[model samples]
Target: MGATQKMTIFKLCILAGAALVGTMSVAAQAMTPAQTMLGDAPSVPKNIVIMIGDGMGPAYTSAYRYYKDNPDTQEIEQTVFDRLLVGTSSTYPARVSGYVTDSAAAATALATGVKSYNGAISVDINKQTIPTIMEKAKALGLATGVAVTSQINHATPAAFLSHNESRSNYDALAKSYLTTDTDVMLGGGKKYFPVSLIEKFQAKGYQYLSDFNQLDSIKQGKVIGLFANVQLPWAIDDNDKNKLSKMTAKALELLSQHDKGFVLLIEGSLIDWAGHNNDIVTAMGEMEEFANAIEVVEQYIRNNDNTLMLVTADHNTGGLSIGANGEYSWNTSIIRGVQASPDFIANDALIHDDWLARVSLNLGFEPNEDEASQLARARMQGKEVMTTSIKHLIDSRSNTGWTTGGHTGVDVQVFATGPAASLFAGYQDNTDIANKLISLLPKAKSKSQSNK
Candidate 1:
């Protein structure tokens, strides 16, 4: 057969398999109207908290469960936050143009209920701006907030709160936040907003707070806090002592003060960063900290029963492949030992040759002495060393393989437990999430009365 014929046959097989799987999943789990209306349908949730762990794929979630459930670690307590299902999306603008989605397009689907181009935000294929669920919720008298470990103007959070043609237009997007009535916005990206934009926010009745100390004074109304200039430090970084969870906890505290309830989107943005840099230690630590934030949300929902908490990711990154069956034995001690050593260099940073040599020594590997000497000299001259090879070596030694240092097409998982969670019982298009959320809102009269 010719190459074109073979390609055609392969695509047919894939379509057949997908159809069979979809039919089986639907047959196995059918929802009744009462079950579907558990949270929002019957009555709008008093509060909704959607947590996005950017680039958190099935591998990451499985790893988290393994560590949490392991008898030796007991890292986290058992809870009802365990049930999960896979999430899906037609992220590409055309069905024939199926491709792995970047954070921008995937988040646009989740936020605006539309699949847009890879770089588009809440705008549709024709570049028409769409009202995001956040905007709609705010219009309905529900207070809104967005918190992320990355720049607040990054693709994921910005998709819900801003509508620029490009995600790279951080400066303009940062300024747009002034027009939003979002109650408690907190995250990184101080540089995106110049002194003028800061002044604009202050003029618009927003109390701009840059430090965690100022959060305590925020009793109600709108507030914006920019902690770091860019993406925040990794959870393992000594500089991140304050931690991302602290910001999330504070946002939840303040948003809950609204009488009509609120909608807050919290993102573990650095998990994607670590994945892009192939930094296993940083990725694992961030995931743990994200779970800590989830615990806080779970506690709030447990007490307030009217709140709905949904946890998911925009897409998978790094195509993280766990375990090396015959090449290496996978054991907890081995993994821990590899992570404990200082020799495992992350490619995300620029280090000197002397530092590389020290890392090589710690890992019991003999690195190129000439290269090490050159790096040391460069460091003396205030030059940076590219540590790509060192990062690859460390990842190989740890037995954690990654297909590429980029996003993958694999579907991610979504876990939910609370009012309206039944709506998330099966595989769903990313846009379906937005539709379900909108359908859950109370009637217009109730919302208007709540505002009064």
Candidate 2:
């Protein structure tokens, strides 16, 4: 075996040992009759929790672990994913499209089990409306909820609950939520809906809330929590609040109370944003928050064997690489010096000639004489060029490298447990994720419902 293979095996063994120490017996005992062995058949779980880390790839997960480790020995520390992963999946869009996929196309495929055009929400490749897993779950009398760190109408979460020809139709998508039976919707973007529509939502029995502190008042019923006008602030900037984990835990609590069970979608939406910024510290913070939320789901799964949990990503962003500067070693600790993302620092704060001073203060370093000259020229060129220059300097100083400022056509990892998770175990198309979950769902009255 290659050296890398040996390392992976070692890590797996360590994970197995840790699981044994944790609660192997609790997991086994909690398995319901449906989960019992039926020859080669698997269980159809009553509850399904889908967690999408918006721009995660192997590099992102690996870098997350590096940051999690003790930095002294570089020994691994097992996260929830280490125990649950079934396999990996190719993130390509439909055969009708290109190899690369944005979150909209990928999330559409994941929600409806249909190959779709980029930006196609829950609509099919031909722009026809298709029933999503959320809709199917609702039709079967199962509770449905969506909790994400992104705006509720964003590509990933919107695909589950709304149908639109273009994901950019945020206002339309927000209005369209009135047409679905999705019980709970949380996260940002209240601005997309006008007061009339918001009142209509409240009139329709959907509780509309935006204050993050008011989440506890929701016990059992329909709710629409739009916490931010846009996407929620980065986890680093908002470190005092574990909003993602709180949202996930709250969704699980609300959805699991139904007698017929539930299906909920949760997202760590801004990992992709961090990737787009090529901000490693911000990405790490997002991943850490995401993992904390995943812990809540796993804890729930330990007692609720009827639930299936799938953790995956739509696509990779930033084409992030850990080893920059031709170094054999990785210093995840270098990120401690970073205070904010270039996007925030450049646009959110006061801009002045002394801006580089704040950059130096946050990044722990200042540009050399020649690099300073380049920044001046870029600023003189325009805001766009200046933004690009700032992000480049930030990444460069930290030994991080990004191939693109946008998404990549990489195959993201899939982690699963409960029910037919084994189906996700090989290289499969993005649509297969939705297909496999649809197949594992509680038997629908009309058999054709599983197909779309």
Candidate 3:
């Protein structure tokens, strides 16, 4: 049979299975799509959590370990990543798009189990809408949510919850969310959502919030939280370094209330921003915040054994390397001393005549005469140049290296646990991850609801 014929048959089966579920016992209702398609299978998870560390490759994880290690200990400590390491996944997009995948394409493959062009969001190469796992889960009466450090309409979150020909269509992406059945969305994009649009969402019974402190006020029902105009402040510079973890915890508290289950997408979106800037200090801070969010999900999974959690990256950025300038050792002590992102430090320097003193205080070290002279010269040049100089100084001190400001084609590690996680235990393509998660979705009910 043709592929189209096969899909029709599959849909028919889902409809029939939905009918059978009404007559079956509660135990039978717990059967997953995999079990329905295949006679016998493992127990399906009640909840699914997928975490994406945007632009995090193998190098980022390795760098984070040393950055987080305790020098006082005789043995190196294990991170949440080391404890949950399972396999790796290749991050290449459609044949038309090249080997190095952008966030949109990579997220599309992870959300829909299909490959598309680099800028496409949940759409096939032909620009047709492709069904995402979120849509499928919502159709099956399960709660769906997205929490990230970036805006809710950003590439990673948009791919899972909406379809767009271009990821840059922010207004359309925001409008699309009004139609989706998503239960929770928390991030930074107040600028994109106007009062008129917010009113519409309120009419649909969705609570809209822009204050970061107000996240805890709403205990139940649908909510949209936009904390900043664009992406949240860099973790290194932000007052609340644990923002992502708090968002994850809030999403869980609301999503877990549904009887059927939920599927949530949480992203460390600013990790990619740090990678793009080649700022080691900022990258490490983002990694720690992301790790904190993982800890929250890990605890939730432990308390609720029926939930499965998967953590991976969209692609590697900056081609980050541990050592540079012919140095054999990387100095994590220097990185750990830095207190703010280069951008933040540079802006502060621009406003003060005592630029050198400010830089020294933030870096936690006094630069040598020659280094200080270069930083002073860059400050005279402008804020952009000053920021670059600060990053270079940190790279020199820490022996860090980066090949590019853009993404690199590299395989990313996959970590998983809980029910049916073994399917992700070996090397596979990015689409395979989505397919496995899709198989875990509860079969759709026979309601006349539209998933668009």
Clashes of 2: 0
TM-score of each: 0.79, 0.83, 0.89
lDDT of each: 0.72, 0.81, 0.92
Residue pairs of candidate 3 with colliding backbone atoms: none
The sequence of per-residue lDDT tens digits that candidate 1 reaches over residues 226-246 is: 878887767765354446677
Q: What lDDT tens digits, residue by residue, belong to model 2 across residues 1-452?
A: 99999999999999999989658544643442223422232356778999999999879988887778875674688666666665787888876768888899999889988888888898887888998999888887899999998899999988999889898998989888898868889999978977999899989898888799899998878899999999998887785558999999899998888999898999999999989877787898899899999888877876777778888999999999987778666666667656765555655324765776876676666779887787778777766676677667766666778788898998989987766555566577778889988876677566686567
lDDT of 3 by residue, 1-452 (tens): 99999999999999999878756634533342222323333467889999999999999999999998999999889898887777899999999998999999999999999999999999999999999999999988999999999999999999999999999999999999999979999999998999999999999999998899999899999999999999999998988889999999999999999999999999999999999999999999999999999999988876787888899999999999999878799999999999999999999999998889999999999999999999999999999999999999999998999999999999999987677766686699999999999999987655455444
Q: How many angstroms is residue 358 displaced in model 1 relative to the true structure, after the best TM-score fit? A: 5.8
Among all windows of 10 consecutive residues in model 1, the one with the lowest summed lDDT is 340-349
Note the residue pairs that clash in candidate 2.
none
Q: What is the lDDT of residue 155 in candidate 2?
A: 95
Question: Relative to the unseen true structure, what is the C-alpha lDDT of residue 211 in candidate 3, on a scale of 0 to 100?
Answer: 95
Better of 1 and 3 by TM-score: 3
